[model samples]
Target: MTILFDQCNENLAAGNAIKLFADYKVDVLIGPTTNIPALPVFILATYYNVPLITWGMTSSAVLDDSPRFPTAGILSVGSKRYTIYVQ
Candidate 1:
């Protein structure tokens, strides 16, 4: 499905967007749709316990499940598992 996220100062806009998706009961967040803007939504997803698919996030840090980022995925490519919210 297509959802619109407005273009604005990302720090404010993207942070507020968490509520918009939550209101719609969105099952998964596909992207901020780009690499850079994805972080704010990633943070909010962690906070809201919403599953985030960082299909664009190239940061290897997210793969670490060291208890530090308990909400991040542990899988790499070739895994059929999709994004899931970790608690």
Candidate 2:
């Protein structure tokens, strides 16, 4: 398997992910880490028929929606559960 890395510049720039897909033609996408950036990238990965594995700070409940992100998987604890753990 080939691995490529690109920085999203800590922003919600789906353009970076687009460039990777268009230029490198990656089969799978691993994450933006943060919830905000991961959101769009996950959608893009699904559109491209690629799987997106999310980790780190990407704990948005929205990411848990299998219907929305069928090809995506979240490795981090979800926000709701994390909150419960914290409290």
Candidate 3:
């Protein structure tokens, strides 16, 4: 397996994600590593049919939706866990 990294400003994540998919042609994608950036990247990954693995500070509950993000797997605690804790 091969891993490639791209460092993108949060605002540039979606566009950079396209480059990773269309240009680099990555099979599996890992991280925007934070919630805001990860949101758009998750949508794009679904469109491209690529599996996504998120880590670090990416704790959005939305990322855990299997129907919405069938190809995604989170390596950290999603916000849903926090919701359960709070309740």
Candidate 4:
């Protein structure tokens, strides 16, 4: 399966994930840049017809707001101490 990661800031983490996917013979695509917008992520997923996964706080907000995301997935990798207050 092909998976796309959104707004990946650090190369080290991204690279590690990519390597892992490669080991499993899965196709992986990182975001175009480290600061990709939510809109672009949606567009990319639509264009590629692949699932999108994101990490951290900002990504949580995007996933929560995007109800129509096609195969869009989010993996919350933040610490358990983090809490989100949505008003």
Candidate 5:
């Protein structure tokens, strides 16, 4: 199991997560930025056929009805939920 992290979460959060995964013999990849298009991650995961997991709030701007990527198995955790209002 490998994990990917974005720049915003590179402090203690990243350290802890990496340690946890390492304990389980899982490799981790920390990206410089989280705003990269989900396509790359999706493609990489699809090519490798490995499961992907996210540990922070993804940009809600990209998660509307027409999401940028397929979120079938993607799991996200955050303190607050994003509210959408349609004009």
Candidate 6:
């Protein structure tokens, strides 16, 4: 398995990173750490029909497999996804 890394810099450069990954015909994406940046990756993954596994972010929406991101799942350690965020 090959690993690839991109510096999204707070979702600002996520689109470019996704494009780069697609151009390389990558099979899957590992993470973006935060949901803000991973959001675009989620959509792009669906556009390219690639699977995206995001870590650290607590977004329950990724588990829904919606049309925007059908093959996406969140790998979060926090429980806010199932509960309320106090902060």
Index of the highest-TM-score prediction: 3
- Model 3, 47-78: lDDT tens digits are 99999998998898888798999998899988
**On residues 13-65, what C-alpha lDDT tens digit does candidate 1 reach at each position?**
47555665667766666555443455566567677766666554334444333
lDDT of each: 0.52, 0.77, 0.84, 0.45, 0.39, 0.63
Candidate 3 stretches with Cα past 4 Å from truth are: 1-9, 85-87
The TM-score-based order of candidates, best leading, equals: 3, 2, 6, 1, 4, 5
Clash list (residue pairs), candidate 6: none
Rank candidates by lDDT, best first.
Answer: 3, 2, 6, 1, 4, 5
| Top candidate by lDDT | 3
Q: Count the backbone clashes (under 3 Å) in each candidate.
A: 0, 0, 0, 0, 0, 0
lDDT of 2 by residue, 1-87 (tens): 444343545343487778777888887877878877788888888888888888888888887788888999888998867777899
Greater lDDT among 4 and 5 belongs to 4
Q: TM-score for all predictions?
A: 0.52, 0.76, 0.83, 0.38, 0.35, 0.64
RMSD of each: 7.7, 3.1, 2.3, 7.8, 7.8, 4.2
For candidate 2, the TM-score is: 0.76
Clash-forming residue pairs, model 5: none
Better model by TM-score: candidate 1 vs candidate 6: 6
lDDT string, candidate 5, 1-87, tens digits = 454444454353445444444455434333323424333543443344344454344443443222333331334522223442321
42 in model 3: Cα distance from truth in Å? 0.2
